[model samples]
Target: MDWKLENIILGVTDVDRAKEFYTQSLGFHLDVDHQASDDFRVVQVTPVGSGCSVTFGVGLNGAEPGATKGLHLVVEDIEAAYAELEGRGVVSSGIQHFDVATGGMAPGVDPEHRDFMSYVYLNDPDGNSWHVQEAHHKGAEG
Candidate 1:
């Protein structure tokens, strides 16, 4: 047996605005936009190369808008990812890394380029925050 996460529900005040933010600004692929009536709607989007999709709409869930935090998106290179987001006009935090010695944080990518150390954060239009972390993996030497 296998378990998988297919979607995440986000409570948004404006469905179209959320859709646009994910699709246009964050470069997610629009998967679905269905409206059955005036009170109910569903808009789903998936980030590039991601199997999990984000769902937001009217009458979907009870979570408060902008309440979702610490959602993570992992990448191989934090600097490249940050640059790409900035080029797309998305406002994000400058790259920062965790200090293993002091258990604190410092500016810029991880000094040793360790995976899961470097990070940057950004928020959606509704203020749902996301953390982008570097998770690089080295290939086995032949």
Candidate 2:
């Protein structure tokens, strides 16, 4: 059997607001937006080049808005990703590089651009957080 992760559910106070944030601010591709009834709706968006998408809607998520945390998005070029997001007018925690020797984090991308060492954090309008990490390996290495 093949097991593949597909979608994540995000709780949002307003569906249209969240949709605009994801589609316009964060640049995710809108996959679906369906309203089954006045109380039920579903909206899905996928990041560019990502196989997994995120869904948010009315009556679909029971968790509190902004409850989801620590979701990750990996990229080969940390600085480029940061620049693109910044250019899009998205607010972020700025790039931070992790020190393997002391496990300390400091501002700016890794000097050597090591995989999994550089990161930036972003939050949606509802404050659902996501970690963007520089990972050249792309999970090919064990």
Candidate 3:
């Protein structure tokens, strides 16, 4: 059986604001915007080259605005991703890597640009954090 991850629902205080951030700042493709009533609205957006998409809006139960965190978006190049976010006025942390030898975080991307080693973080308007990581080995079969 094949299982696929599709949509992730994000709790957001303002759907329009979230839509703007994702579409304009993050450059995600706006997939859907639907409102059944004043109490029910959902907006879906997908990152470029991503199969999975995120949804946010009103009337989704048990979702607290700004509560979601640690979502990862993998990129082939951390520098390019960081540059794009910066160009869009998104405040992102400097590229960083965890030093396994020293067991501490260090400034800059991984020296070797190793998969899963380098990351930069940005937050949505509602404070939901997203991590962009350099992952060059994804989908390669052993």
Best by lDDT: 2
The predicted structure with the larger TM-score, 1 or 3, is 3
Query: What digit string (tens of lDDT, one per residue) describes model 2 on residues 1-142?
Result: 9898999999999999999999998899999999999989999999999999999998885568999999999889888899999998999999998987778999997877778889999999998999999887443341
What lDDT score goes with residue 85 in model 3? 93
| Per-model root-mean-square deviation over C-alphas | 2.4, 2.6, 2.7
TM-score of each: 0.92, 0.92, 0.93
Better of 1 and 3 by lDDT: 3
Residue 99, model 1: Cα distance from true site in angstroms: 1.3
Best by TM-score: 3
Model 2 poorest 10 in a row by lDDT: 133-142
Error of 1 at 90 (Å): 0.9
Residue pairs in collision within model 3: none
lDDT of 3 by residue, 5-99 (tens): 99898998888999999999999999999999998998999999999999998887645888999999999888889899989999988799888
Question: What's the ranking of the predictions by lDDT, best on top?
Answer: 2, 3, 1
Q: Compared with the true structure, what per-residue lDDT tens digits does model 1 show for residues 1-142?
A: 8799988888787888888889998899999999999988989999998989999998786578988899999888788889989988999988999998889898998877788888998999888999999886343121
lDDT of 3: 0.89
Question: Which scores greater on lDDT, model 2 or model 3?
Answer: 2
